[model samples]
Target chain A: MKEGRETTGGIEYVVGAEKGIREIVRDEDVMPLLESALSAGASRVEVTDSRGGTLWACGASSGNNDSATVERRPVFLEGEPAGSLVVEASPGSQLRLNDLAGLLCAALNKIITNSLKRMLTTEIHTSVVNRTYEELLETNKRLRASESRYRELAENLDRKVQERTEELKRMHTRLIQQEKAASIGLLAAGVAHEINNPIGFISSNLNTLKRYISRFTEMMDFYRAAIEEADKAGGGITEAACRKWSDLKLDFIVRDVEELISQSLDGAERVRKIVSDLKGFSHVDDSKEDIVDLNTEIERTFNVLVHEIPEDAEIVKEFGSLPGFLCNPAMICQVFLNIILNSLQARRQGLKLHVSTKHVDGNITVAFSDNGPGIPEEVRNRIFEPFFTTKDVGAGTGLGLTVTLDIVTAYGGDIEVTSCPGKGTTFVIRLPAERREHVKVR
Target chain B: MIEFDRTEKRMVLKLVFYGPALSGKTTNLLRLHDLLSREGRGELMVLDTRDDRTIFFDLLPFFLVTPGGLKIKVKVYTVPGQVKHDATRKAVLQRADGVAFIADSRVSEVANNYSSFENLEKNLAFVGIDIERIPLVIQFNKRDLSDIVPEADIERVWRPTGIPVFMASALEGWGVVETFSRLVELTYDSIDGKCGLSEGYGLDREDFVGRLTKRVQGS
Candidate 1:
């Protein structure tokens, strides 16, 4: 198939079936060339493809003429036969037929080679471009998948972090609850003693009253016996009955019995009042948030801590008419109790705690000022941190301020501490008077 | 890493040429294909774009037979040097026994070379191949071009890394074989140390090198 027609080199190359004589050889190109060949004395001329299909034809006779001389030259495309040209010689014509056929063959080969080159380059370009486009599509799909995966991971991590933080907050609240229970347990011992003193006096008075009642009953029995004896003797008084009445001292017993009964009733009333105070101060159902007076809860907390306060300690109250705000009553009481207890612990003698409440700028601020040895500057900053304490381990769980801060902030309130060494300390708590939507259980 | 089949008495190894775009990675392979004896190697397979630029990869395979009849086959590959062809480069670098980093020697390409080298290090780590432990050789290609960096400057900066460096004009076929030979030796030693190829399998070092590096006729 190497016809030595390709312009690059002598190497052989195969042309595809797609490149046919019909596509390359147009009628305009072949007709003029063939007409000139015939005028130069060739009688007939015909062009056919590789498969011998006629592309262009001009014949002198319809059938094959055996008298005419024929010259056939195969046209080559990319060093392969693509078509052929046939010229029949006319008789007695002075034309160089060999030179004419040679020129026509060379012209046809050049055109086919040129067309083949263009077609091959175009095919390679389109195919390569198509493959690259497909690869790019696949790459884009993979990148999208990867991006979604990363986004999913990030979102999952965020959820996990939130869950962990919520769990920690719950654990923190439980710790505070346990600390409050421990403090209550400590206060209960003191409360029992306070109630027991009145109970003891009431029990003693009841025993004395029992003896007085028996004395009165014995005097009545003697009087009844004397009356019976007199009736039997026809309404005459007996001397033995009269002597017993005189020896028993009935007049003094009557006066002492009335006094005993009155004293017993007074002691019983004292015991009842003490028990009622204990019940009111430790209201266990005061867990849920409700609209309550801050001053009232503070007074109840003061009552609960009465037994623990030193004998000469003075508690001063400056009350303002604050509107009821949403709060957990027990938690608010615990907050006041913790501050008072700390004030009591800081000073053993001549301690004064001034508690005040005010409504200003739509907020209620409760302040507790103590004239005890205030917190030093170095230890003041870490007071709200959990497990930070200056007291002995058994005396403090160190979560008092921490719990106070947590509960206050949960109700959308904030606490500020002002202290100076050896002077006084004040804890001011500011709370919004209205219930907020984001209030949480601490 | 390469596969050594004891049952079949055959070993297969791979070497990859890696560098930035148009930095002579394919040129190095083409030069080796021209210089090496045809009996020792297979045909070079190039997957190129319409403009004759390599878009995927090129492969040239070579074989060697030790004196003790242990057959060894080595496949040399060139990854597409374009930045976007990272996936193809990683695929070709898999299980490669050695790497020849072909850097451009022109002054303007110095930054590109360094960045590509950094990319190589990052990709090696991502593929779980320790760049510190892998057998590697650096080749400054296109040395015959004008405005190239001085050999002294390259050596001064690279000597501290302790990797062997060579300057090559891949278009002219000079220094190509030397770079190839050094990488082959390094690969052989690493494989030998890992699998006891020399002690247990009776593989001779010089015999393996000689079989692959023999010159072709009239080259």
Candidate 2:
């Protein structure tokens, strides 16, 4: 119970510490009992506090304040010792003052208890009322705030619509970009297919041309030997053919032609490899999930992304042998591309992205670790949220990690990211070694 | 510090016990009441709710006018730790001189403890109390229960806070008095340093704490 509430100016609820005993035990309330006990053949009656501070007494120093004739008992308020009753019996009194003292103590305690209960009830009721009033005030404040917000919204309704319209426009642009990307993939696949046909025939023609050139060289040698034989017989026709061949510079021409054809063959081979990489990227977009050697799929994805990688960037690979896994290779490649590109863009130079693969516990785990400025604490968890980019507007759509998460989760896999703000970030992706449906029931 | 009457030389200091709901805050107060009442100290005034929880606040007050003509009154209060009592908690937390955060010792209540601690920090700031300057202690209650957090692990996590941490079961009444005494001492020291209690009124730290903690009759 709080005590001693003074009307301190500008203070609402200031109180002293002790809920004093005198407030509950007044003289008017206990004087009648004291006088009655004095008439009940008792020589003396008294009431005092726990500290022996007297509140009421109808007794003299009878029995010489003797311990033998005196009876004392503590009074209580709400189960706490608040005061006491001390009754002294003169030697001539026939009544036991101890019994009288007990009765007085109980009576006094009851009065104090009832009074304390009322006080507590009042205090609690007041607290409840104050709490309700405060609550109403809070509610009013909130209502006013929301009403003002609504008014503001109404005043700027057109601006609000325009803002939403701008958002819709950006969404439409993203939709078109996604459609264009898919179409480009299909078109690139078509181009690769078209180029593959010409490359096959050109390669065959170059082989045939090589064989013919060799045969012509052998024929020229045979003719040169016959011409020599003719010269030995002093034939004018053979001598004229030798002079025309020398004038044509046939020796240098033959050597140069062979080298030129070999170089063209090498260039054609490189073109074919590039087309193959393009096919890996594009042709798989529309295909069903392939039973892919995971390592080979990783190699194809990296080969397609080779141009984007910096020339001096160190990429360490720790690829473990893994079993064939079922996944859409194109979608998986997108995940790889997004992660690797994030690593590349994380720093200006000396980027070291460590990619590792391992098979353990029926899952093939791939981890991409980057030596770059890592994600800050505040932004780490939200990095995968769609449209939650830290990059400048139009610089990033922020859908990369979201899409990667979708692809990995769709394959019944999960991704984990661990990063130190100043050191680096690591993204570990785990996909099942085999499709869930293919697992043996036994 | 709640109030100071310069003319009367009276200083009222308030200490609050706060924690998550069912984290043994009121139990600690009850233990204090039980142990302290036996020593003829003040009765524990529990403003108990109908649900048997703290709604407003539980108060146990110590009033003393020292031999040196200075009145130092200490009020120990426990706020309702339930989530819905935010306003009440904030109100009771205002002008608190010290705080003892009673954390649950169960291994499962780590998140609740963390959120409650954050709430304490935020509410302290809301009440215009500087958290760094105020005296604060952490007590992990319910150490008697099974599946409680290991002491070593708790220390490892809370050691860097630089606040004194205690392990106790209020049910057994082991560490309640120690927590109470420490809070009182710290509160006294803080007020003494700032308000010049010693130089102004000859207030002694040991004397003040001894008078306030006189109710802890060892069970």
Candidate 3:
């Protein structure tokens, strides 16, 4: 191996023995001189061409040349024999110059071989490190992609689970609702039977009353003819017949008959209205919503449920002046009916219920207040939750408020409850004052 | 209940065989498959199954083309007998023209038979088929086995329902063809009365029944 060479700033150049040694070292005569000088321990050893141009040298040593004998050897580059020196001893010693030349030649050869090995080792180490770095970068990229994919899958799985959970909850709610409706249907059947009995007799009594009214009218006509004949005849016998008619209290009979006729008409009308309300609340035609008089609906509901209230209990109403709103009248009536029924159940058999309605801020507000034992603080919050009724399981499904809330919410309304434990409970409902555009047109 | 439509000149009817597990439903189908004439029937398609029992359903289709050119296609299907396969039962029960409830004749299987009948009613409702109006027949299979219920007792239990009942040994191929033919005749008569198959489609009752019976009996 040859040592690397660099030139300093100079136009004129001295070709060292190592630089031009390859061309001169082939001379036959100089070969022995080179070998003899290296063997004699000279520090510098050189062989030149016959023209004295520098050829090959070995062990080129550089140092201060002093009075004591000193020698320097030349180094070779690119496998050329260049100038050389031999040193018999160190420059500080008194060794002869020729002896020093041989030692320098051996030293230069060792320097060149060691430099070549170092360069090769460095190059191999750099290549290995570069390849290892590239592999690590590729693996990291794949790992990151796998991580992101797993994250996306986890997110999708979470969303799917949420959707399925919600669907199951909805299905459960619907099942409970169906069960409650079935029970209500059975109860309604019994109630309808109870109502039909009285209605049947009321209708019969009205027909009988009509006959009595006609009979009484005929008797009055007979008396009027007798009186007229008496006046035309001017006779005692006709006048005596008039006095007998008076003595028999015909005036009292006529007045009492008139009063009875009015009372029977009122009774028949009440029965008719009760039947009509029963039919409406039963929701025989339940497929669609209808435009209905809210006040009339409330009145009918009160009539049907009034019997359920205790005799000593009082019901007060503050009905607001408002136009009829489009709604599913039967369902709305059911809402009020359930609330009122629940209030009656909560009362101590003789409590009062106050129902009021008013228009406030473009919304209709209806409030139902009962002077019954108020709801406990713990249960007041969950009263609207499905299946959370305070009544025993068989008596109530606890779905009334939940269903009412659902219906009112579907109609774009909200409900609130306020209660004090010892005082009573109040339920306030706020519904849009006007029907929706679609409902209005329908 | 199933409705039979003879709107097309070809009268196509659907019959469903429903029962509980181990009640000889598949056995009856197999017996019919062996006895029926190959030319008049389509291939019997049994869906994937588990434990030698149907999980989805079994279909055995037969065709009886009358001399009047009216074709009567009878597609017979058997529901999965296990209690859990309700959805599959409902799917097969849809659009059914008639139903044959295969009850196990063994005394121990009576409870399962009634429960399966109730399940049949529920699944029929799910598919909007009226259970009362369909031409329904009940067949008690495995009569050859010991500990079987008496025929008189079974009739006494089911007589009030007003449905025809038959006793059979499906494994021995006894009473299988009779049960199949009775249901076929009822189905045909029902369709004839409703859509006037005989008058409107020029169908002959004797020829139709003969062809259907011969095809089902492999004669």
Best by lDDT: 1
Indicate the worst ten consecutive residues by lDDT in candidate 3 chain A. A10-19
Model 2 docking grade: incorrect
Query: How does each model score on TM-score?
Result: 0.60, 0.47, 0.36
lDDT string, candidate 3, A1-442, tens digits: 1222222111111111111334323345345555565466545545444344555555555454553555455554322233443343345544455544555456544444334324323432343344345546767989999999999999999999999998977875684456447545644664576556656666666776676667666666766777788789765655665676676566676676666667666766766766666676756656377777666777877876655667888899999876666787766776787778789889756788999988777788889999878999988889989779788768777778877787677677889999988888999988887746543111
Give each model's clash number.
0, 0, 46
True contacts kept of 3: 0.00
Those runs of model 3 whose alpha carbons end farther than 4 Å from true positions after fitting are A1-142, A175-183, A186-190, A198-297, A303-313, A322-334, A405-414, A432-442, B1-219
Model 1 has an lDDT value of 0.77
Model 1, position B66: C-alpha lDDT score = 65
Instruction: Write the residue-wise lDDT of candidate 1 on A1-442 in tens digits.
Output: 1122231111112112124566765578668877887777777888887677878877583354444366789976434355788777766556666777888777766665555445544544454455456567878999999999999999999999999998998898799888788778878898788878767867887787777678667877977877887788766455775566567766776777777677767777776766666666655655667788998988888877888888899989999999997767777777877888888899989999899999999899999999989999999999999999999978899998888888888878899999988988999999888856666664
Model 2: per-residue Cα lDDT over B30-112, one tens digit each? 88887763433456777647578777777776766666687666778888888877656776677789999999999899999
Superior candidate under TM-score, 1 versus 3: 1
Candidate 3 chain B, which ten residues in sequence have the lowest lDDT sum? B1-10
Better of 2 and 3 by TM-score: 2
Candidate 2 scores a chain A TM-score of: 0.48
DockQ for model 2 equals: 0.03
**Candidate 2, TM-score vs. the true structure?**
0.47
Residue B92's lDDT within candidate 2 is: 69
